[model samples]
Target: MDTMRDRLAPVLTRLLDGDPRVAVLLAEIGADGFTEAGRRHPDRVINVGIREQLLVGAAAGLALTGLRPVVHTFASFLVERPFEQVKLDLGHQGVGAVLVSAAASYDWPAGGYTHMAPGDVALLGTLDGWTVHVPGHPDEAETLLRHAVAAGDDKVYVRLSLLSNGDALPVDGARFRTVREGRAGVVVAVGPTLDDVLTATQGLDVTVLYATTVRPFDAAAVRRAAGAGRADVVLVEPYLAGTSTAAVNDALTGVPHRVLGLGVGRRELRRYGTAAEHTAAHGLDPRSLRERIGGFLGAAARH
Candidate 1:
């Protein structure tokens, strides 16, 4: 199976070649993997060498000089460590950049708590006008990355995860697409969690919605898909728990509704294991999701 890295390499090459003003900054994470690109575009592709803060600051500086900077690193390093630089240097300065993060959430659980960053998306939520994309598959990642780069002067975050869905949905911008219809309620699957969501809701009767873009939240689409009044909303995000709860709540303001947010657990597991094992531990596996969903749907029906 092709990973997001596989798709991103060629797209980066194309992006660097097409746009003279486009540049790439790395914090020593994927320097070796991007050898070919670096060799081709010596001036544009720069390795900042293990300094996350400086990586973002430099990118912001480049953006100020009319260069479109695409910063790359792990989620923890990209958003968590140098967040101040992202907030002050990039956001405060009003310079736009496309931040691409790998090893999403627990994709590298073996890397332990230091590498895991379920809170990355939530932290970015604190900032203003930042577009976030959590692609389910490599195709979706490619589409989102290319689109983000093409969108001039827009601050964007593209999250890349190891887990992939079976099918590729068309890459529409920041809108929730209806996957299935049912009277029970709505199951909104975000990013890589689509496969688990589909499996969890397989036999159940509920409307399913899919979205790669979570920052915008697509409230109108949620309202439309949820039918007329308040409907059961189960948000299955790939990031921290309850990241999109506020947006969903604001969308259906007048209607009284309840939400069950599911994602990586807030508490640190602090154990070394495979990603699958970590997923089960956090009750995010297909079986666990099914049980939680069944209970939520059942309770909703009772009320």
Candidate 2:
């Protein structure tokens, strides 16, 4: 159980240690910390200036020359600015590289709208042959990153949250954890909101599902958890209530499924706040989730 920092540093070291041709691209700001790590394996690290579009485009070009490239940048710039490059140069051209997105979702409080790109999932989902992964903790992050490196996918986007000090939840990229399996109701959570989901289920006969992968969801696992009889399923997220929840609900057609999509609303968000604040303001806090789950269960019981 290595700390996330420990896990990530060594994984980067190994990637650098193994391939001299492989380049590690970092944002100007991220360079400070990553550069120190790169000192242990200096030749592999390259700073791509503040140009995220060029960074991704360059990575795609380098991949064409038989060199594996790992690009790192804020999620916002990576997804928005170089969207054309991502879809055309990387995805359409069938380039093999990993786009390591830092500060995913509400993790970047200091980074306002320009810096915050919570919709990376929605953006990447549209690209063909692009593998999208959002790791809940550092351990899983390391594993998934390594897999992306070796994997032969044309394009891969990994949305990484800040390092969590808490214990890592049991995740295997396929079977999500069902913390509690009760006949009463079902609560499904996606990435890092497990705490809120758990809190929302107190004193209720609820089955909780931790959905780690928003794309390529496990339909069988979801259907089993949703239960065929009379259980109610609620999908929870920390982003806009669209793709992930909608996809799951669509998959479980004819089943009783409800989505509680929680994220930054369409309205212009003004204040800069931490992930906790954003979740709370968006009705994703534990108390709010608890109330909603209780009401849903109560209604289900009556029917």
Candidate 3:
């Protein structure tokens, strides 16, 4: 399959060629020189220093002028700094703009807190009229990006992590997949964590669900997966606990749901390491997740 960057480059290039009114706002260092080498129409690339707020504001302005703007930046700065701009400027006006965030979670190593952002899943999910997508693999990313651009929603946040060379999951459009459909238990995995979930529950007799769209989660499908019997559901996310996991649990009501959150706890994370190392340290690694799932299953079997 093609790399995430390769898949996106062509689609973005085609968008530029087809739409003269479409503009792309990318960070100075984050563009990775794709704009220069790629086929971008003349003057369509807008570089807004390192100011995250300015990036969103400029995109909002561009949207007001009937030009579709795609804002690209690190997840940390894109969501935190320009949150108000996203909420008021783009969200309030219902201006169609796509926020492309990279290095979601601790994808980058040694970049420290300034670069690592695991809370975007939760933060972006809170906005009204804003769709949140966390693609697990390159193929899914490509398909989702194309769909997001074509859908032309007012506000949309697409979370992307470093493309892992591992096998890509089969994703068709916006539909989520059920790895194992059983009435015993449900394990909902977002993004690449689907791999981890499969690995962790090797011999377990439980169902695994892969969800790409966190916001406006498929309630009907989830209810169907839960079945009418008493089932135990668990959510696995590469973000802090309070956001995605809590929200999913609350949505599942009556059903016994548990959240397996990765990254820092309630306190701030002060240590610096690679995404894998950080995740391992915080009990988000495959081994940790396996143990957690085993425990959940063991307890469930008791009663």
Candidate 4:
């Protein structure tokens, strides 16, 4: 099981060599990974020395010059801290850039809340024309990276976290794929949440839909999978809870159904521990996730 970063980090070299318009904007992260690329393409590979604002701003400026800029940093710095720069420099200016994030959600809980960005996807969703991808595996992550660059100025957000599934699936860009089929209900897993979602719905009669692209929401595919839009829909995300609630609500509008959302909780745990510890604290571990699904669908066994 290759990690998302392991898969994506190499794409920088390919992009630099293949396309002159491609640029990699870094905010003091991934320096070691892109050292060779920076040396080879001195003009395109830029590190702004921990300044998140300048990272986004420079990417936007590069885009203004008709260059395709790929910005990389931790989730919090990439989205939360320099958000205004992202909004105005990129979104407001109507210029396009690809924002790639690692250490997502609580993947770096030891780094504390300052590094935690459960709201990155939700916040970026507010911006228009963003093709958000949360690939469960590295192959998928690499594919999305290539897709974003080939798109030519299409705004893309690639969320690379420490968590990942066991296997890889061929991604069709913005489409969602069925992990398993059933009739009782539908359990939709976004990004790395697939493994836990699969384990939680083992005995339940529900369809599991895996999605790497969440911003586009893929409502049509989701509705079609729902089979008349009646099966209970459960969205299991690795980020903020209820982050996709509105999109889901609107997607299934006028169709009778029940929805359940599970993810990082709203309240801050304020504890230092491993990512798994934070996950369990927020009721996102396998056992807690199973209980939420079981109770909602009325499974006979508690576990």
**Whole-model lDDT per candidate:** 0.88, 0.70, 0.73, 0.87
Give the best candidate by TM-score.
Answer: 1
Task: Tell me how far the alpha carbon of residue 82 in candidate 2 is from the true structure, in angstroms, after superposition.
Answer: 1.4
Q: Of models 1 and 4, which has the larger lDDT?
A: 1
Show model 3 residue runs off by greater than 4 Å: 1-6, 37-40, 163-165, 254-264, 299-303
Candidate 2: count of backbone clashes, pairs at least 3 residues apart or interchain:
0
Q: How far out, in Å, is residue 17 in model 4?
A: 0.7
> Which lDDT value does model 3 have at 256?
60
Candidate 2 similarity to native, TM-score: 0.87
Best by lDDT: 1
* Candidates in descending TM-score order: 1, 4, 3, 2
Cα lDDT tens digits, model 1, 174-225, are: 7888898887888899998999988888878888999999887799888997
Stronger candidate by lDDT (1 vs 2): 1
The alpha-carbon deviation from the true structure for residue 229 of candidate 2, after best TM-score superposition, in angstroms, is 3.5
Q: Which stretches of candidate 1 lie over 4 Å from their true place?
A: 299-303
**How does residue 233 of candidate 2 score in lDDT?**
66
RMSD of each: 1.7, 2.9, 2.7, 1.8
Question: TM-scores across all candidates?
Answer: 0.97, 0.87, 0.89, 0.96
Compose the digit string of candidate 4's lDDT tens values, residues 23-114.
Answer: 99988888888988988999999999989999999999999999999999999999999999888999899999999999999888788889
Compute the lDDT for candidate 2.
0.70
